[model samples]
Target: MKNLFLLLLFVGYSQAASACDCLMTPVRQHIKSTPYLLKGKVIAVLDDKNKEGRDYHLFLRSIGIQDTVSRGYSVKIIVQQDFKGKYKAGKIIEIHSTYSNCDMLFSAGETYILFLHKAQGNLFPTYCSYSNILDGSPASIDLVQAIRTELKSRD
Candidate 1:
């Protein structure tokens, strides 16, 4: 009986951990599917009192493709109601996620390569999108290059 209980507990924990598992799609696909893609830093993170989520204002640093984006644009992201993370101002991060799979996780003062989607004139990040931290990894570098290539091709 004890062994069976332990096995069940382990299985439950495994399932919970894999709940947010997502398969990484190609960079081109991500760019083509979304309306906007850029690299920016978090200027402020505010609580949406009307809704059960948080809104993030990102300072647009560099855009992948030159569209109608400005230098300082606000990318409003709404996460789960229970989200309690602290996003300080002046933190460099990326925004590239959809709103289907899960909410994107971010930490202050960290740089990331984000893929962004537009809905109702608001940009959002999800866990199912292509994103990477600028941790000096070859994969991260490749992703950035791929985004630049895609943007150039569109032009």
Candidate 2:
């Protein structure tokens, strides 16, 4: 009976550990399926709570956001380059990210290659995507080159 209990405990732990595990998708396939892909530096991080109130409601309604209220923080990023999307360089854009364990959180002053999806006029990165910090490593350089090559081939 004790051994059986131990086995069940292990099973539950394993499932929880892999709850947010994401399968690696090929770069080309991931790029093709994802909507927005950009490299940017996070300029600021703001608490989403500050956006509450009447003006915020009006803004959300104008933007067609009816029910979804993200309880996470807003990350403002300065667009350094856009690999997939046509976001203009030097422009600052705000993207929302939840505090959930499965989502990638943005930090100020750090650049990242974002694989973003748009929902209700908002952009966010998923943990399963190829979105990663741009730390100027060889692997990052190679990935960026691969993305560039793929984009050129399509052009």
The most accurate candidate by TM-score is 2
Candidate 2 Cα lDDT to native: 0.76
Clashes of each: 3, 0
Model 2: residues >4 Å from true position, as ranges?
Answer: 1-19, 48-70
If scored against the real structure, what TM-score would every candidate get?
0.53, 0.72
Q: Evaluate all candidate structures by whole-model CA lDDT and list the values in order.
A: 0.48, 0.76
Spell out the clash pairs found in candidate 1: 96-115, 97-126, 98-126
lDDT of 1: 0.48
lDDT of 2 by residue, 31-141 (tens): 898888899999987773367533454355444455256466678999999887768789899888654446565678999998888878888885687888888999899
The best candidate in terms of lDDT: 2
Q: Can you give the lDDT of residue 103 in candidate 2?
A: 57
Candidate 1 structure quality by residue, lDDT tens digits, 1-155: 99999988876875465355778787677778765455544444434222322322221111112222222223333221111123333334334333222555455444555655555554566357775556778987887777777777877
